[model samples]
Target: MTLGREDQPGAQGSSIQDGERDSPSAAIPRLETGIPRLDYILKGGFLRNGTYAVMGPPGSGKTILGNQLCFERVRRSSSARCVYVTLLVESHAKMIRHLSGMKWFDTGMIPDRIYYISGYTALRDQGLSGLIDLLRRTLRERRGTEVLVIDGLESVEQRAPDVLAFREFVHEIQGLSALSDCTTFLLSSTGERSHSENTLVDGVIELTDQLIGLRAVRELTVHKFRGGDYLRGKHEVEIQSSGMVIHPRTEIQFDTPQASATEDRKRMSFGIASFDAMIEGGLLSGSATALLGAPGIGKTLLGLSFLVEGAKQGEEGIYFGFYEPPPRLCEKARKVGIDLDTYIQEGTIRLLWQPPLEHMLDSLAEQLLELLRHRPKPRRRLFIDGIEGFRAASVYLDRLPRFLSAFTNQLRMLDVTTLVSEELDLFTPLIKMPSPELGNVVENVVLLRYVELRSQIHRLISIMKMRESHYDRSIREFFIGEQGIEVADSFRSAEQILSGQARLLAGLQDREGES
Candidate 1:
């Protein structure tokens, strides 16, 4: 009798299968893991009836990932059963107690749709052969088991006398999974796998906990997937009470498409009329504008005004800040005659605040992407109050440029007019940017500085760069008052406004002398 399609080698239709011609409809059927982002990374989901290895060190979320998968499966299909065989001496009660904390864990499905069995006693008594026999008998008794998860494969490896014995044990489970059409998961603490063990599995997912300075970061990498194209890199993984959440690296999440044929030529206001005139009507739509200045130079206030203006125009705005909390920011806005609380209450604005410290760059990117994903309309205004905050959070300083480039490109693709504020050194006369490469990423640069004129401190704003747009280059005097940020005429009387100490121009000095 000819074997059915399901009985063929690589029954899940992995692309690695030799000489197998699968129809388009029969090509790599997938079973969703009930994880939205993980499903996206897997190109839909894991191949049905395929054996995969979830390899990671202890406390690296190996057990949680396995249990989450099992619970998700049983939750969807009441009749579908998952056999969870624990090979380690860890108590089943202890495992259940831990899983109970996750939101996805369902106590009603226990013992009915999901069965937990102990293989430790059997493996301890009769060795590798006994463990294999136990799995075979369990499969035979529990007919129609859709999923089989063997937790603690390292325990079985410990019992095996040699490498060959361990290989035999893996082969037995592989054969059992194929015969029963059961999707199998083998959990191992160590990332190391023998040649046979690696070749026998259809895919391998590795989880790691890395210490980058004082921060401990959790990352997940798809080391191998025989028939699938996964986002290849160290993607960020966060283990929360909800479950294991994976944040695919921003650099690889979306492909940068060619420039759109329909360009947005509309300009947006800065809410300060004179400031808008300096920037030539205002910033162009979808352009990235950098607000470069020292601390307390009205950078945050300008960003707030930008958001308030967008909110007034019925556009949605987001403020991703690191310095001040939401309430403090709202209070500050009120002091400047901008009502931020009203916009926030009306659902036109969102404030996301992360304290200044060592933060995972991927985590921040994920948070921003999550907010973008849930919004009903496209975000019109985005105020990243602290670009330097992201720079400080990055463990690898060299990668910051690439991250920013990807991030800015994504913002442009979404048609978001972005304002990123960078804190410059107050004492330094020479202008310093967070990164020199940033000049290439942004389309505009607005410089705010404190200039000393005859011992009196004054504030000035200038348009340093505006790509493909016309703007006033003259340094204009600005002030912060009860009406918020107000810009006046350029400091035409001074010669060294950019020097941080303005002196009278020779012509102006001569005119004053004549007077």
Candidate 2:
């Protein structure tokens, strides 16, 4: 029998053993994550004594996230000492008060193990020597210190006198972390600022806020992590009274190994009997469906229909109107035979006005979180009107996709069937196409148009795409009425149904025969 090069009979086993030792699985180590969902993202946790950078915009919870990690070490008793060095505005007592509000400060035991020292002195003095002296004293005590959190590295930059000193100070701090044998978390508020700290750290986490209209949807991106394999992409996260919580996104793939054969367990009906029948017994629960149309169409009315159905089913519903205020929408729904008063009075429906567009993404996500927190039974339906209202309100367009993905996934996880409406009358047909950000996330899309026949414009409804379901391609004639929406037969002509013109196919055939 012929043997390969590595498998020769005389070859020593040491070389073959070395190949197995270098495999990917062998490199993985079990780690303890200081933060809750953070461990899940770290593929266990950070390596011991590694430096990590946490960055975000102002009021984006960077300080709170760092505090949670510092307190976590205290709880585990892995460290007899944990230090928090802050240079931002708040004093030590005020900072402790805020951390206490999160319930992170249990009054019982181990409070003494946690320490907070003001870094303003070193920052104001503009000397690395003062900072080094403070660090040496803290580290020399040797009380089994395990974690150290440094907040507002930018403050040091302000007083370092020059860029060279600032860079040098950061380098020394990295060296200090290694000498102390404690994992250090450095916080920075980085937007347009130029800082080399991102390169100096062992790991870097960049926080981004995407504005949908006026909403700042916060996301975390792990830019670099040495000696670890982590998820790449912007991830949704929220800061609550409980501290930092990660809203992870699950990309449902049928081709993957764990795809379940059974569909989701929950199901809910859209209120319209005819429409529900058209959709084969209404939309599945925890899935997303988009209703697209020009203004004056029944998109909002359809959203209310689902809410009414949810109310009847004893399930909760939230109606967020971006274009229409709640009072006006409720009044209109009343005229259309959907007495929202009944649902509101019964605590079955929640009507919320569109939040400021500057933080539209954040507001929408926070609304869902609020509902989940207050209503533990789970919401059955969510109706978002004027999703495109955010376009005019958004400062950045690229951020919309990540925001929508986060919002849709949250709804799906809650087992809520979401109905989203997009207003199409504002732009011309060519420019008004659904941006790719929204086109791919939703499961079903329904298009409503104003079609002209015989010189009279009539409303039409067409199923654009229905994921995993069969839908009729023909556009059905529809109307807004006192009894809500009504669907009619499809237009029989073929010249141009949606445009302001159409010619009868039968009439054209007859004319050709005569010619």
Candidate 3:
């Protein structure tokens, strides 16, 4: 039932090549994959009648994604026929069943014009002559098709009489694509070697895994797209019972608005007044802040406070913890009166326990991608209990900086006002450790430490850094309470406390109970 609008070939090329681009109406419509964020990457969609390849390992969702693309075109053009040719897998029935379950698919819109062919193995076994003959017939039969999907091209390569023969066969398919002027997709599972099939294809979408939590987390990246610009990053995706879900990439844009330094009271309480005051207010509603200190210095406690306070304000929150056990962390929050249990039960908060640092395999990019995918609220806050916990837990420390940069960019874009806690080296006098990637990425930094004065240990709070405000530099004594962190009245100490040294004020009483 395609509307039968054949795109004038010379016209599409001339308009684009003639050095003067015409409006979209004069050009052939780009092929769209129904996935919203995905469509954005494909640059107005795939070029009409272009050859595209999806290369990945087995179970990377190449075939499933291909099927989804076909359905997307069929749904959009209505008249454009979709022809799917299968080789290594039997996906037709499963694809149809899966699409049928989606709310977008109507009972009567069974895509009457759609067609498919299976048993490509026999054709491959027939050798070069057999493949050419089958290709000829398929072309003749599906000439009117606007879109074509060839699944498991690797199967053809495996059965070809020889390596050279397989390579030649791949070349022929590329030629066929140009002559037909029909958008096409080839599915391939590539190995470590240079893939002859990939070289022959006009575009390639690669899927791979990042070892995380003792399991491989799936990711996708577009290596090349001849006629379009795509987001250049390995994005996290998942194959659930419903179908393939793609998590779009997030990169920080310099144009993104910065938080105002104004003295506005839009502060988001972290349920700790002292911590909030050091930050010039609590965390901003749409700003990112870091609680940077050494291990066991209460970084996670600060993260929990942000979550607890945000939840109290009726805003949702998510804790992506890379270290602590879920139950243990939740219990700790409960003891502090943060009441995370109710938040979980009420669906206002989500606690995603990441694999222990050692078993975590996914890149920071992938982890961030997953968090956004399952985020519970549209306008929620995010808390990463400790970044160093993730670093200490990772087996591959070399990639840490890269992961952090990519992750920070994503968090800022999501506008979730992240609370990224990190553990630093306790022996160092510095309030915060410098992250090569997170350079100036943090909006504010709150430092917590144990300062000793006259044989008594006191918890000190310092406003190490605030990007947009003139925060008080005075170090203050603080106490952790059942209701959360409380700032004790200002430090009226006899000595300077920040450098681990102090001098008694001449008039200040050092005697017992002298204020």
TM-score of 1: 0.90
Highest-scoring model, lDDT:
1
lDDT of 1 by residue, 311-375 (tens): 99998999999989998999999997987899999989889999887677867876775567546
Tell me the lDDT of candidate 1. 0.78
When 2 and 3 are scored with TM-score, the better candidate is 3
Q: Residue 390's C-alpha lDDT in candidate 3?
A: 59
Alpha-carbon shift of residue 355 in model 3 (angstroms): 6.1
Cα error, residue 397 of model 2, in Å, equals 2.8
151-177: candidate 2 lDDT, tens digit per residue: 887787777778778778777777777
Clashes of each: 0, 11, 17
